[model samples]
Target chain A: MSLQESGPSLAVVGVTGAVGQEFLSVLSDRDFPYRSIKMLASRRSAGKHLTFQGRDYLVEEIAPDSFDGVDIALFSAGGSISKEFGPIAVEKGGIVVDNSSAFRMDEGVPLVIPEVNPEAVAGIRAGSGKGALIANPNCSTIICLMAATPLHRHAKVVRMVVSTYQAASGAGAAAMEELVLQTREVLEGKPPTCNIFKQQYAFNLFSHNAPVMSNGYNEEEMKLVKETRKIWNDKDVKVTATCIRVPVMRAHAESVNLQFEKPLDEEKAKEILKKAPGVVVIDDRAANRFPTPLEVSNKDDVAVGRIRRDVSQDGHTGLDIFVCGDQIRKGAALNAVQIAEMLL
Target chain B: MSLQESGPSLAVVGVTGAVGQEFLSVLSDRDFPYRSIKMLASRRSAGKHLTFQGRDYLVEEIAPDSFDGVDIALFSAGGSISKEFGPIAVEKGGIVVDNSSAFRMDEGVPLVIPEVNPEAVAGIRAGSGKGALIANPNCSTIICLMAATPLHRHAKVVRMVVSTYQAASGAGAAAMEELVLQTREVLEGKPPTCNIFKQQYAFNLFSHNAPVMSNGYNEEEMKLVKETRKIWNDKDVKVTATCIRVPVMRAHAESVNLQFEKPLDEEKAKEILKKAPGVVVIDDRAANRFPTPLEVSNKDDVAVGRIRRDVSQDGHTGLDIFVCGDQIRKGAALNAVQIAEMLL
Candidate 1:
């Protein structure tokens, strides 16, 4: 049979999750090939009917036998769920592309951002008669590197300092709902209900809700620091970040400062970004318009703008750029599907 | 008359404006000594009545002769009004402590942040029978310098990078109200009302509404850069900033990266900030609590937290810090009032 007619069997673990639902949209948008598909979620979300590319499927509760006869499984459940089911799926003869943080740093598992480091998962493919696991980076890290990696390839980034204005969608769909509800209540002169977050999330911004590590950086910030080093394969590359959760809905905006070993002028940098794949330059200084979260909420390409020389660094060795991308798509589902596409 | 019985006669310009109203509250909170006070606004607000220090005063229209008997004039109307009236107030033999950007960069005009550079306006008193202009630095500059100056004094900052999360209050009282109104409208499935700001600000954040300069940095970002140099009296210091307006109410938070000429450990930096005047340290990593805009709203002190060594720089020459201060209090009115208090 032709490759198109005999595509690999697929299963979507955590089919009812935020990113999991997005995986279906991205898959349909790209018209990814799959011979057969199964839906899996927790017992609470089981039996839920979901439509994917005009086919109806009922999500079944995740179990040891769920991956039987499946060739590829996309997992977007929480970290604990991924840890419990990822190895089991691989043992059942299926490749797992996990959207959780469970196996991202595992030595044997390949952490990939298809556009940045596709070679990391070169030999891992569906229908190879062998099972393997590939890890998708954190949402913020995926969004940030989509812009920085191209620049890094040119200037050899020696150090990076990032400050993020993340959106509520990074937490989950439930958190986004709470943000809207809390905002409405606060506007009506009522006290806000803080459930997903410890503090008020309406009309105010705060540090990311991730647990703080002993080094004073939260887990989200550390993810950016550690993930960048591993993905770039540079153990000595220095990184620091401060991640904040703003009141935006779906996209995240970041202010990035880069110190490079080679000089990169603003004009050259702008030219490079304009030509880089998966990057849209929105640097319109005359119009006073730059990359904003609202403009890139549901967009696919990561927008880069406000490109300028870092006045703080002497010479042309430093540059600053602002970026924005959809947290659910480019940050999670879209990236995972792109890796799966390469597998075919 | 004894100095205690009769103090400087003060005039509050733009008495009907938000910062103008805040001037009254801060003055009363501190029980600032004054021989008498005048409430001055435009002809539009000439008939408005304002109560301060248990006394109700009618707002008066400003004219050339309004400063004839005034010892010190606190100006907060706008740039145009300050440009026309600041010099007139000074020419009328009164010290003009301006809260506008009109004279912040002028030669011989002192841009003072009491916590950072009280010496900038040294030996200038309101009752000296001579006119002078003591400029109140921009609100963001005052808040950032309050934290950076303490660390700079010890290590001598050579370069600084700042990313600001500003609030709606910086735009004015109407902007704050508009943010709340727009958020409510958007939540109810209605298009947001874009009166004060040109874009939707309810569930969104954007680059500062300040006009973007030719260098790709907005006017607000430039204010942070230029004002820091003038306040610190360090023309050699390099600074760059990206300022964005978040949906918070009255306080602003900033993430600052500082590169020092001398090596200052994080412990010593924390100790210095704890003792620094007008600064409160809130670094509690265990609780995942850091300085936030809500906690610092309407408060006088600039809260500094998240103090850590910048891993990007070696030899302890770099540090990262987060700071929050009431945009109306420490940023504008309180800083102006404190500058005026030095005249006592």
Candidate 2:
């Protein structure tokens, strides 16, 4: 693949979504070249006027012919919409980079976290006559793997246990608005409006709003387990997760425990993460300043900290790490954009 | 030891603090019999009026002579106060069940979780003309152990990993008030008050405010590790923890992973915990309702749920459990009062 002098035509699906908005911010920040861009949304949001990079654009209702001239389409409209439109976009001669879990686990579709598994998306690029679909890994998976894959590459991870502190943005733009509204209502001694979540979300956390599976793990957690195996391309690796919906507004935080097949010393593990691209090491013992959701809310880089030897394992056969990354940016839009950049 | 018909004299030190206030609630709710009671506090809280059990009482400043006729003292004053005053109460012929971490790891001082290790305070009684100090484990340790010990007894845990989602009450009464105030301020677009914690506690979670240790683990995390070994009476058990303080108000929750020396099937483990003392099983996958901080607030029993086999571990050698308990009640005051009841 080689960089082209002129970029391909791009389309932003679900332009009114939280992640969709971030796509524009990140595109503007990076100056991602695009010959033409289109904004597409649902019928209700279609006529809305949105300005991007100092130019006005109107959202068009997504149709069967929406991808007719689009060289690349970034989709974050819920899973159902992605499941329907993703294949249509690809079949219509447009490469689709999806943020939903639609085609993530399909055998033929590539689930790419560019920093962790760039090679999986090889031989695919924008403007190619044959269009294809590439899936973006879940937010929690992207943040955890951003720090873990560097160490996993050095010492193979045999098992992983993850606990996430997620924010409202994972649910979407209305959920974020609800969190703000609910907090204010709760503060004013009124009943909080529970539209998105069943239970109260102000100053509380619950199991991820994702429906629980019969196996007792929610879909959000299973995504970490299954997606890590696919992205790392190592099926023998074991993973379990307990996902919680915290009260934060945007960034997601995770406490990850890793057991390796081979010994990876803590200092060496820290050195590997420090040099890994797209990751910033924040392990400072003296300041007691590690990664917080508020610290990484709008940041592009996923922050890694609390790098220490797991006391449960003798010597350094295990390591524990804490990570934080913007839920909508790196976890969604920026990652899809990164995959698209690789396509060019 | 037989239960005494007429209970001994009881005194509550630091009666103005959060845990101190809960001491009165638990005592009155349980109908704990006491021949006489005294309210003790620092000079600042002295001369203040407090009513308990429909009787008005004045808070008295603690002096060396305060415990002359007192048979039992429930102390929740800070560690330094406990260090200076614990021995004085014991020397003045009163049994002290200290809530601070002062005497927890001492050679003869017993760390008691009434449900898990009641026998640790054996043969000690109020009004016996002799006194002894029994320590209450940290809130996180108590909640984790209340659920883990039942399974540990059946399978003999070899290694454990813990991650805590603690509440503001763990820091004390002022901290809880600050959380409410900070939430309102942040919701109004004003800077949050950061008096109790260094970072924002409104809609954010942070690594515990406890001091960081030399090994990069904070004091709160180490307390879970060391206290578990002491309470379980197994020094060889390997333990690691990452403690985080969430924005919740009262209850503390923990995600605990246990590796056992013997195989314990998930169904059998659930049955055992269903019958365990101080534990209530909430593992209903159908309802998708596991333990939440709000549900467990002001509740006596520790709520345990999300029990499942660790898919990472082969067969049944490992298990994962999530638990929540009242941080101020069972974690501190209720546990102290339970120890006092045993002293009778």
Off by over 4 Å in 1: A1-5, B1-5
Give the per-residue lDDT of model 2 (tens digit) for A14-47. Answer: 9998988998888888788888889999898899
lDDT of 2: 0.89
Give the residue spans of candidate 2 off by over 4 A. Answer: A1-5, B1-5
Interface RMSD of each: 1.1, 1.0
For model 1, residues B123-164, the per-residue Cα lDDT tens digits are 898888889999998888989999999999999999898999
DockQ of each: 0.75, 0.76
Per residue, candidate 2 scores C-alpha lDDT tens digits across B79-188 of 98899989998888888999999899999999998889988988997789898888988889998999999999999999998888999999998999999999888877
- Backbone clash total for model 2 is 0
For residues A1-344, could you state the per-residue lDDT of candidate 1 as single tens digits?
11255788888888887888988888778888888888899999998898777768898999999988889899998899999999999998789999999999889888899889999988887988689999999989998899999889999999998999999999999899999889878877899999998888887788888998877788999899989999999988899998999989999999999999999999999999999888899988877778888889878999999898888888999988999999999999999999888888
